[model samples]
Target chain A: MQAVEYFEVECPEALGGEYYKQIANDVLLDHNLLKVIDKLHIFIDPKVPVFVAVGLLKKISTRVRVGDFANVNPLEGKMTLVISDETYLASMLKIFWERFGKEKVEQPDRFTVILYNVPATPKEIEDIVVGDPSESLHKDLIYALRCIAPEGFRLRSEIFTGTKFTFVASENTLAEDIDTLVAEKFRLMGEVPP
Target chain B: MTLVPVTYKGGIFQHDIVVDLIEDLGGYIVQKHIIAQEVVLQCFVPREDIELIRQISRPLFGEVTDSPLVGTEIAIVSMSLEIHHLPHPSCDIAEYVRRLGAKSNMVSLARGPGKRIAGLNDEERDVINEHDIAVYLMGNFETCIEYKMPTLRRGIEVPIVLCGGPDKEVLERIIDPPVEGYVGNVGRFMRRTKEADELAKLDEIIDEITRVLEKKREEIAKDPLSVYPARLMGLIREQIPEILDVTSPTPLTVQIAGLRVKLPYDTFAERVKKVAIEDGITLGEVAEVLPSRMRDYVIVKVLPFSETNIAV
Candidate 1:
């Protein structure tokens, strides 16, 4: 069986460092992957109670295309979207409705939706604006990524977008060289370079 | 030879006491068995030496140092509608007692059978008296235990331990002839705990039961049997081969002096008479075989050889 890597992150300002740590520990233990040499970092910004957890994405099968998650077809005038993964269909539709108001959205089936007047490239639709990005949104995205990542990975990095903020998590900060400047700041916090 | 019932693992302490007490009294164990419940069934000492064995075991009585709740057979008297809660206390107490090497049970009184009506029923009364100890689990209200006392007031000469959620003092004040004592903290319905503090209360209950059994041992010694059951069983086994094949519900019952052997009334009498010793004296020559008083079973009692002037 292919090993799955899992990680979790939270913005301390939105959820708190202790909460993310508890969630991380719980998830890691539940998955029986605590011993893996994955680097997990929880970042707490002094300006706000922002906490972010970042870890590496360890396992991925190149054979399974991303289109398996949702249908990608280039149509004239706009790109059409059809989802085959029924489980994520609701969330995808919710995102679609938030970006394109309910009046403009059309759902023909449980797992099928059409985004009107969209670019041929589906990645552009993925980048469509829904809700304004906030610290909580970044934390939520990290949490979702942690839920999706395979279990074996140890290193990860999380970046906060507000004020051009960035957070990176990895197995070894010293070996990976995330940022020499950032390492100095972390060194002052008594964090040994790994 | 006598039959001593011992508990396994957790009951090691009590098992030692019972073994020592039996051997020290010059009583031999004819049969040994393990009883899972708090009450044990023992057939010890011949009919003639029952009083002696009782006397020897008297000193070990009433040491309730162990949890009063240990070895207690609780009857969760509740309605059919409340059957879900039956397992709650039984599992809780059973798990607690298991740690101490004891056992408990949760018995449900028949539906439409309140305490008063059920208390008067012969079957219910017999079951209540059958156990060495009983716990009458009541509801939260004081009146529940009070009103239910009448149903539980059968000929239960053994300890009747009470348990409910109410404060111990409040229950004591409300129960008129008050039960042995009320156990508390049985009301909390929550997750299982492995913490020592969580089990302390149950330990206290087990201690109470041990104390009560000890006291009973004292009272039983007041008038001991002449010959213990152990000696009688040995004599019966040596003399009667038919007993081995004669299967009755309770094949061996611990009597005051000798154990009672229940065999089929019609078929085994002749074979029982044919059992003889090396010198060729038959069992019929020493013991009397007559119809049992309570059931369609034969009752055998040892008659002194001197009385019959026979030696095998």
Candidate 2:
């Protein structure tokens, strides 16, 4: 789709290519995996009864940090945190309790948490990471590829790199040289992910 | 007399005579429901005498429309109830068929997943055979469909219509032994069919089903059943009062051959076998009350005139 930077579906016949493009578009959109993918290439060889899919993911930079959700004030004896977003507050509190003692980290109100006798500076506290979007990118990419693969193609081999992924599926067992086949699909798109 | 199915939509007033009229014309009342002050009746009447019912109902502000799909049940089958196939197209087709007053159900297979592994066992086939017709929801790729359909269609005695992504011509050429119809653009669906073009695809499936069902009705009419399923349903409901105690949507599901009574087969088979029509001929003598594959229901398939030599 136009949402992705580059998309191509190669099939033995033009009809299958056209129909599979629509199917892939619907499936990827249904899984909400379209925006995360930057480039994709799909090759369906029905005679060989194999489906290969490879894609390049966009740089996901959204990592929720302490400073992003709350304002930190360094008091005389304690550090005060005014929580603005509560979505990741639980995870943040879990991390705080592990770094400091459970008794020292106290939540006095729903939106205010105080730490007594904290050793770290405000800058170090603000840099504490709470949530990262790229952690689940591989799982989501594999799931989307599985949905796009033909129904009976259950046997699968998947490889996910930092910003690239490849999925190969077939009804039959994977052949001895399946990685070479997957690499060939990536070659169709001008780059073979290693 | 050829029977023409019709549905009556009007107020509750003057509805008693409608049943009497159908019985007098050697027809049968399929279903009737009175809610609030309105009444809806589904019945079949002699084709030549259908106008008489319309004429008699004019004064009561009743409208009678031909409902060919009445008294027949259809099954909307999907490979599985997974998110890929269910709710969108299978439920959509079933809802569309029900809109025309036919009874429809959604059936999901347990073992029909992979292309090479897509298959239906005898129990699944029997469940599908319970319906008058079946519409199978299929995938987009022709190659996968080619490998999968033969396995899926095996042992399915009832007529099957395929909903997939290939054009009708392409499907007709690829699939062997030809199904009832093939509708493209109904492949995997992510959204409900709300737009004009999307709904038009649903209409295409409905139109195809109607055509095949109409043709099936004609074939079954050649050597007609000794009794009307509508009348048998009425008789079963009247004699076996326990039938009404069931909680299913439709206690009795009418089909091309006969009716499916939603009661345990082992307990009610003997009682249903004794439901008599006009003469001393009980249901067991004229029909086969067999166990249904779906749960513990019973299906009654009345013998044709050639077998019973009796017509009412």
- The candidate maximizing TM-score is 2
TM-score of the B chain in model 2? 0.92
Per-residue CA lDDT of model 1 for A1-194, tens digit only, reads: 12423333433234233333444454455444444313444453323212234333233223323355666665665556676666546655687667667766677777667666643367666444333223244455455435422211235665543322234432223244446645544444344443
Residue-level lDDT of model 1, residues B1-312, one tens digit each, is 433333212233355665665556565553344556332323233345545544544554512122222322344333322423334444676556544433343455553222223234555555445445676655433434465565556566656777665667776776777667567644322224446865776776677656665576455456443334345555666666666775553454433223356676577667655655446666666667665543556655545434666533
Q: Where in model 1 is the C-alpha error above 4 Å? A: A1-194, B1-83, B94-106, B112-120, B188-194, B227-312
lDDT of 2 at A35: 89
Assess the local accuracy of residue B309 in candidate 2 as a C-alpha lDDT between 0 and 100.
Answer: 88
Per model, the share of native interface contacts recovered reads 0.00, 0.47
Residue A117, model 1: Cα distance from true site in angstroms:
35
Across A24-106, the per-residue lDDT of candidate 2 in tens digits comes to 89888887788888999999887678889988888888898999999999989899999998988999999999999798899
Top of the candidates by lDDT:
2
